[model samples]
Target: MLLSGQSHAATESRLFLDGKELSLPEKVEIENLDGNVMIPIRVVVENLGFKVTWNQKSQSVKIEQRDKVVQLVVNDLMATVDGKQESLNAAPLLRKGSVVVPIRFVSEQMGMEVDWNNVDKVVSLITPVIEPTIKEPVKVPPTTGSGTSSPTTAPVVEPSVMLSQVNTIQFSENQLKISLSASVQPKISRLTGPDRIVLDLPNTMFSDSFRASQGLDNKLNGRLEVSGYPDVSGVRYSLFSSSPSTVRVVIDLNSAKKYTLLTETTDSTLITVQLREEDSVNIDPIVPNVPAVNDGRKKVVIDAGHGGSDPGATSISKKMEKDFTLAVALKVEQLLLQEPAIELIMTRNSDVYPTLQDRVDLANNMNADVFVSIHADSFSPTANGSQTFYYQRTNSKAFANVIHKYLIKATGFKDRGVTENGFFVIKKTKMPAVLLEVGFLSNSDNEALLFTEELQNKVAQGIVNGIKEYLGIK
Candidate 1:
């Protein structure tokens, strides 16, 4: 056998920075910090409730939160928290005339761990390390042949590749499943070690070409590593099959190495890894170790802002912002039902008040993809229109902007655009978070329009469109 050669390339993955999500194709590179790891004095301090200011003439970075001022010299590599010298990862690098400090150290100082995984390459700042199970195994099928090799197969027959006998491959909807059959059946066994469990298919000298790829759909983290299996191409996926157990590792090929990633399904959903080459695998699927979000469902967290007698802002006719948020949210529930890909959730579906912290807690528990808080803005009686707000710390500004732009256009309301606000729900949700000030209840024009079913449909349609765009839907 001259070995008919072909290979599958993995898709791309990404992370976020400065409200901008960076798409890293193959590897996530974390540069070693040369400076002392003082809090960035920018990202960390400001995120931790400190006020921030930029001095152009002095080239200084200043922060004030809770009656304390933090000052830092841009090039001097020095700063003071309440007037004290502190270390820095990089001297405040000047960029666009503002002091820019390294992201890792700064986020770390804010009591968070700045992590950049090299395999999938996503920069995540978490309060603690979530040790998601990593599956790494080696399986061997019962082999009795001329002591040579044979071909592999897929459960669904692929007409493109012509091989003698390709073993059947199936995924277990219940427990992990595996099987093997060949003229020369190879030994299939389970292997386990610290933090990994995988199937080892023996006598398979895998031949492959490692090709670098980028994030496929902002969900998958593809990495290529050469393990013994020909099915594994590019960065190998270390799947977690619960330490050591009997699992199937079938090598079916014409010329492709790939891994299938299955996420919870819904309407308006995108299955990115399917039909793509196996060279890419979801190396670091955010395995929810937290029981709160580990139910394995594509979760959503909806927030209704300014509640609990807080009533937020009010209008002359006495249409409370809280009441309207609840009403529209209930309407949104009806609209979202049209698409099964999404699950509808709300901080307050009823008139009951939910604290900002409670909203954040609910969202975190849900492991939300998009955290949306509905509210009515009250700036001035004349200020009428719809707007959206997001936290500058939790990077999702692009997504926020997308929704905000279309919402204003679709609603024909005043355009307040997208903004970064320190609302509690936006500040703490663990996923792509945004808060929509759907309209100005204080504005007589909008307050009257808010109750109309036509306006509700427009807002729902706009929100649905925004979600489709983010998911790269046509």
Candidate 2:
């Protein structure tokens, strides 16, 4: 009677209570099985002012709220509501060590309204308001009817501020703008690990149009993907809490950079976040091969294409191109480090992505003698070979020819030869640069060979030899 197999592949459903999103316990999830939205019993009932208890002996659960009581047995279609037997579309069950029950049955039986948004996979439960019943005045109130009673006024409650738009704009600088229907004091803080900037707006909710535009119905959370901007990865927003009606907005950052929050004096509904480039002094410590005073050693910058969030290509076996590129680039660095006559610089030593402009700037600012970028290509499965590319400028073609010769020999694939291409990194760099596509990741045979450590070492050695031969080093 337990759910198994492909039923677990169903998308996890989001739970909301009276329009506020409820954070589920870790490892406990809301699931849709056979079209029935199953929600964790304890999470939903407790939020609705109900007490829940488990009976291990009978494998049953009891939920109580005021004078009402509901009991459900595991894998049983029959449930008891106030001692009355009722049928269920889907029986209560255990998922990820938590008891989950059918949202509609449990919610409706407890005098709560239940709504499901199938498109967005959201389950909304609304608790009905209970108004106090008025009793007829007694005969004693007639004695005081001669004196008029003064009516007391109720306190006014302000409506929640609406978050109308969250968008990015490019003007003099890249700015993230948040539009609101009213003014709000936002709590701002910075987080690390994967760097992010978080802003919390009090008493705010997403406007109807904004929510619908995000494809969210009754769901209080969504994400916006920012394209063409190098500093930012994406933006995420959610109704963080319901008690105070707080909205949380998180900005995912690519790297550590200075940002300014612009507050409008006359218009308080608009919030602007401006991104600024990191200071040179703050940047030098993290960047490799930035010389305070050069001693005339030849500088070479090694770039490993695509990393972190950007996986360049997927191999036939599903290996990432970023991993292969970094592996070979590191091996080449190790081989080149032993030479006293050559100075080595790496675009990235770890699995992190630097923007293409960042890579070009690093080489140009360091005044590197040569620049080389490593990448794995993806095309038809039948395509297998090694190729190198260079922009049509200076001695770039000659630089590519020297590297391609060694690279083709090490890879032992069909030689694709050197070609001219206007790749961003190679074209922007001031000195001679070449982008090497070592092997076709889509080809099974080449993918298998490229992943081997022995082949990576050979490829690394070939690249070092090519750089040395090009520079007339022994």
Candidate 3:
């Protein structure tokens, strides 16, 4: 039996081997360090058909798995894999007398597979089992959405509902509202390949003028098609399935964003979706906006704050704010790549921490049009909100105001509004800069939402939207 730590063992996560739960002697210390999952060495290595030996003299652990030989020392950042020295993103450490190593490092070295379920907090390992055990796959409901489904369970199907048409798609203060004609509430699911939101209307068909009606023109397949609004790229409807008579409404997104499904109680026909568009660019009334002058391409620097030794905020789920920030920043970086007119620069892409001065120097040296520092806030567990900070002397207040407005709307979190702060990165940068606190990690609900893949993408899009608006990108 392995020894477990005494700190908050009740909420410890579990480990699985080939779909079968392992009875671990100690609570697993599954942590995200440098964006990689770290777990106890004995629990993972021994379970994977490997033999582990502890060397008390050198304070190192040795493992022999098949032909692979690995050595890791406690509190050391270097490991020996088959006599080759390698650097670890996170050092091996002794957690309550038990040694823990990076999960990816050990798994890759041993030729084993590893997977993590953020929602269930389960770490799964896949190894060659002589007697393979078969486990039933978790049942997921039917999804009728046309694009990819977001990382959420399928909504219950209401087979009796009927849809007539999508009446209007409107854009308002940081929201894209879609109104539809329906007899009953529709089931909604979201997906992320090319960024799409899907609506499944049971027992419904398109209206006669659903295709003919046009309010906004968008270029699709070299043809001018009505997109209903500027924020959404295109909308398509299809009979996904005949047996269930499901009509799927697919919203082709121009950028990463979030949505809320609402059905009018008094008028079931009026189904409205509150969408946060990351591509939408608007003039900020709060500050004087300077339009992009050169080549119409805006240069942006995205800084993910805190890394390495800096844990930032610890969430109720035990996720570090640094990990969340980097994850979100990477997602934003991915979405921004789609814009041919935008030049993107990152402060730090990996787990290594970048000094505040280094971040500012990178932005200034690049002559970046704007600099954004992404961070997650920490406060009392009851405090839940998103706020943006700007250096008081610069025009960052305008950038902060614009981005903060869209960010809070996209997150659907309480708005703490834009405030002034002389943070090192924001104050030292010559260009317009803003520091974004996405949400308070201490809040349970906020932490849970932040951990989801969908919300992370949405938050990235919100930051992109702010940049687009500030730069006057079309």
* Location of the lowest summed lDDT over 10 successive residues in candidate 3: 219-228
Q: Put down candidate 1 lDDT per residue, 1-474, tens digits, no spaces.
A: 233222112323344432244443233323334633222234434434456787878888777744345577777766786576777667766543434566554543332334454455344443211112123333433221111111111122222322212122222111122212211222221111111112332222111211122222221222322222222232222111111111113222224322232221221111112112222333223323232344433455666665566665566488787777776677666766665566667788776776666777887776666777777765334456777877554346876988887688767896767765444456556666777878866668888887688887777677777765664545
Considering every candidate listed, which one attains the maximal lDDT?
Answer: 2
- Give the winner by TM-score: 2
Q: List the lowest-lDDT window of 10 residues for candidate 2.
A: 142-151
Which pairs clash (backbone N, Cα, C closer than 3 Å) in model 3? Answer: 148-191, 149-190, 149-191, 150-190, 150-191
Q: What is the lDDT of candidate 1?
A: 0.48
Deviating ranges (above 4 Å) for candidate 1: 1-297, 472-474
RMSD of each: 26.9, 21.6, 22.1
Give per-residue CA lDDT, model 3, range 113-158, as digits (tens): 4667655567766542111111333433433323321211123334
Ranking by lDDT: 2, 3, 1
Candidate 2: C-alpha RMSD to true structure equals 21.6
Q: What is the C-alpha lDDT of each candidate?
A: 0.48, 0.72, 0.66
Candidate 3 Cα misplacement greater than 4 A, ranges: 1-296
